[model samples]
Target chain A: MAKTRVPAIEGWFTTGDEPALVGSRGKETGSYFFPKSVAFSRNPAAPAEKLEEVALGRRGRIWSFTTNYYPPPEPYVAPDPFVPYTIVAVELPEEQMVVLGQLAEGADPAALKVGAEVELVLGTLYEDDEHEYEVWKWRPV
Target chain B: MTDVAILGVGMHPWGKWGRNFVDYGVAAAQAALADAGMEWRDIQFVSGADTIRNGYPGYVSGATFAQALGWQGAPVASSYAACASGATALNAARAQILAGLCDVALVVGADTTPKGFLAPTAGERRDDPDWLRFRLLGATNPAYFGLYARRRMELYGATPGDFARVKVKNARHGLTNPNARYRKEVTEDDVLGSPVVADPLHLLEICATSDGGAAVVIASTDFAKSRGTKAPARIAAISTVTPTYPNTVIEMPNFATDSSAGVKPPETTFRDSIAAKAYDEAGLGPDDLDVAEVYDLSTALELDWYENIGLCKAGEAEKLLNDGDTTLGGRIPVNTSGGLACFGEAVPAQALAQVCELTWQLRGEAGERQAEGAKVGLTINQGLFGHGSSVIVIR
Candidate 1:
């Protein structure tokens, strides 16, 4: 039997055929915020304005990328035998913002380059006996 | 703003002593007081830079230090601005002096950090971006450094060898400094040969976390003159500005950069504006700098700072380093105290340590690492969130 798949952090991103990050947009200023700033706008010009939840662009260009050779400290959960992973900062053109995520599993770090296009996908951040923890990751387009 | 004189500066050597942070802070404060030729009672204000690691005393650091030094009922203020805490404390003290509330002030900062990478406050804090980045993406401090270093490589053709050269230069600079933690010289081969912590950033290319403390004694110029202390190193300006709206760059502990889709980005990038504000306040420019101390969290970040602080134009830092313009004997020597590369990072104490080095250089007290005829100096550093710090000192 397969283990249950669940989001590592709930409501931050959608897991499906076309995964997209959940972001918030300022009604007045049109500024976008990731992880959805529901309380108020972050922009000083429109601080009191209401923010609306919106889906961010699913695809972006790789602004820059790097591979981590060592495991990060807690609250980062590493596997028993740790495997290195590549992290990417992707520039979403429509949003004019840069968002960070780990490169999807099986994606080649050597093939990654600045300005290369990548799309959002769901991948395992870590797993336990009962469940597979999912997170938003980037994959080469 | 009127200038305030830095009458004395002192520091406890940077090392992992695994002792109570108060020991370091009290030692540095006493040293600064003695160096200023003033007793504890002379301080009208005590401003402490806070450390989050040491529990309650670290939180109320100003009162903590004051009580330890036998409180004279001096007014106290404690500041916490991540790595810029020290400068924040200094800014608070300078404010009181300029407001005529205090004639003399003691600014102190100390830290007792953990062994490995600086981690976020312990908890299941999903809302906090600092924790979110660590838990969700497992992005450590070196991850951000790796991103910036790779960007530099992609943007300016900066090589791993170029990054290695930075450690080599700083190690050589650290050799002559007594207070530096890593006092031995390091070759480029040594740096390149070290383990790779982050891609494009070797283990040696990154700074370490160490326990340390630093302090400064400052006073109104009039008060300094009355004390017969003439021609002290004066703080010409202190820039504690925040990032303007639409900060496009991805800073530490943040998962995303601000969206420029709605609002256009600021005219000056956040990092550039840090020193620009100080230059504007001091009525000075990059050309006026005789020496400098910049936050070198990673070797490649130093190259980024060369452009950020206007030492050279963007993409020209590698060329500047190649020309030996930022070395100890160069035209405008930077990080003559060996910077964070030598001292490692002690959070609250790091920024004040930069100021301490500048004061020593401006006063011609820096013996071996001294930049000859140094009269003007600048220090620039940034902390997490939106805290920006830059201070200019002139003799």
Candidate 2:
């Protein structure tokens, strides 16, 4: 089996620990991706969406993406701080929704185009004293 | 409604000072009070635009600024509506004056922004869209801007050159502004030469974050006359309006747009919806505008504002821009104070700063960047997550 993806942020994954399976309560679009991720909740019900998992087959084109030139934020220490990684917005064919997530390791976002192929993967985000919020990520398929 | 006059307007310029936001705000507030010939204690009310300070303060901007100004026991109100924070503060001041609650009120906004991408404050919270975008998509504000600019290019046939010219025009205008952050002129070649942070948009096409503060003193018409002022540039309207839902549009700091599942979206774009509310309230149309100040977070967004503000019809921003209509001395000059492009992004203070520019232009005191014979002016700004602001001013 493919090496299990490790969570970038701990406890955000639904399946085996995978950096690809970061999970969060999907917002209004009703897919497995955050419509807009925020540090605080806009609605009272948002806290419940954290760490919930649904189907992941949704796929979409890369709307736009960027590569990490620096360490993303605190609590996320990679083996290499400057390692190149991609983030993509994949349009899900069945759900007709788009999910945003970090690209699989070694994927280059700079070379990707707007309509590039993309799919969802579970991800691992960092965790600390507070919480470990993981969710879905996008990668070129 | 009671008429209100601007007693004073002051700023801490627009640049990175590497200082705390409170310092900038206090400086601007003091200057405005001095200009208005009043002490800080004389002010009856204080309004502040909310910001993300070093410590988590929620959005208690009014109390924050009041504390910075040394707490004069005045009624404090903190207003948060994303980019419209400044204007919302202004509105609060106007309402206080018109309601006969207070004769003079101070409206201020200031921010000492964090370097690089503006992210949600720490701690894992999957519920907030602003934070989720960073954690999941790693999407920066520029990415949304790039997406919009690309969409503009695809839909409106706006070329990268067109986007570059916006920077050139705004920079030329900024070159004359004493308070603008970037005063040097930028050429189209300079824009093209810069590396593309997002495809179709070069580095020069984006705005940088800055530490800045702006404050305005608003008093009633009688209060201004009593203070020996004959005629002050007066505010006609402050539009702190929200968008009509289902918004059904993809905007900054949001991953997906309104589902369009529940209800029909309005015919006007979200930005335009803001201006429409202001125009309706002020009983003024776009044709009557002498000049305009818009949020140019990026080169393309400025063009987007042009259409939204009714300066031109949809998809014709490039035509107006190419004709030199948006430059100083054009039929309706825009961003005569160099706009966010030259001023950099100062968040809460930016929207109020737009009105400050208008007050100066309407008074014909803009010097090098003056819009000749300007009578009526408008400032349009929108904040992330659905906070929209537009203000109309007339001399």
Candidate 3:
């Protein structure tokens, strides 16, 4: 049932049983990954996981966040003059892990709080003339 | 370790240089060499506080300055300990001179920081502690400063006005300092009006990062006398120490503080510990200090430093500051050279610049800001990670 046709962390996670993987030498250890793509785990020697398998889907509570009013250094161009956005840590329950992602548009930091619920959505970070990179974004739920 | 004398010290005016950091470093080094009545080739070693070089060799400033000063073939060492980099460089140069490894050594630090919040390195690497803190907590450096500022207000009964008073006092002193970044007086009302960067801290309450440099020429006592330098400022002690385990309090850019699982933290704070070690090595108490240069990253932190350096009993810093004990003409002058608050943060170079100010104060050459007949001076700086540095200079 855990497979759900989604990508799973091979040799790490299995349904109804704790995920086990070979760690340091021949020793074996249990590891847990959340949203599988966001690789939050207790053990260092865990197998790569898929995002769909472990994802605590969509909207989560805002753990904490800060607005980058100031321009970031290098490679990141602001949306013209000042493109301010909140970098929020959202707590996902399915994996019981907190994930950090940029806040979506129309989300005002002044209205945000410690436990504010947020929704994860696919977003574009920035696009130069040559290429584009997909980024994860969060907005008020 | 061998005793070393601060034979010469110099600095360039700190501000928006809009130029390369190497140029400022070379200028400061030239001034120091000139002040020492020695040529660049006369120096035996060079140590610089390293800065992140954007693809330039100057990132490792020791070699950068060595090459800038025309390859003196002297031993060079580069150190980075956040704000404490300057003092760490001083300690390294002093060690070389004391070990008899080199008779004369030069310590220099400089940085041309890009404006605004210093962001973490670009990449998806989660293994780096610096990166993890930013990604997980969104805890900027100013956030930690705000935490300390808030704690000060809660514990010490310090008012927001009191923090502004530190800026006023330091800016007033900076008016006499040609090299200070801000040489004008500031008012408490002005501080109140400044926009908030963090909760309790206004724009003016926090120090701005700048591009600047400072250099000091340190030599063995014998070397100083031979060079016709008399009554040189002597470095009596240096503390380059780290904290004990179980550091519960959250430092800057850290997502979660220590869990306190293994062992208890020290009774004294990390800052206080650095000062205590310096005093022990120098065989002097806080009372012996005529002047001091402290890391005043924020106005509130300056008051905290007074307590950490044993200027007064804990919680008495506010009272002492209110009573003008830390002003230029007060009992124990702190930041007489206008500190980081007035001088601006130059990262790795700031701590070395603190000692330079101390050397001047100890030699009774601080002009208008001179602590009357000052005999002993101290400078303190705390770096990121687990590093800190303090130096006691006497004449």
- Scored by TM-score, the top model is 1
Error of model 1, residue B129, in angstroms:
1.2
Task: Judge the docking of candidate 1 as incorrect, acceptable, medium or high.
Answer: high
Candidate 2 chain B weakest lDDT stretch, 10 residues: B256-265
Residue B273 in model 2: lDDT: 85
Q: After superposition, how far is residue B171 of candidate 3 from its true place, in Å?
A: 0.8
lDDT of 3 by residue, B74-125 (tens): 9899887878888888888888888889999889988888778776777865
Query: What value does the lDDT take at residue A15 in candidate 1?
Result: 77
Complex DockQ, candidate 3? 0.08
TM-score of chain A of 1: 0.97
Any runs in candidate 3 off by more than 4 Å, and if so which? Answer: A1-141
Cα lDDT of model 1 by residue, B192-220, tens digit? 99999989999999999999999999999
RMSD of candidate 3 to the true fold? 7.4
Would you list the rank order by DockQ, best first?
1, 2, 3
Chain B TM-score, candidates in order = 0.99, 0.96, 0.97
User: Per-residue lDDT tens digits of candidate 2, residues A76-129?
Assistant: 434343454555555545434445566765556556777778766554454445
Report lDDT (Cα) of residue B357, candidate 2. 90
Residue B342's lDDT in candidate 2: 90
List of clashing residue pairs for candidate 3:
A35-A54, A35-A55, B2-B98
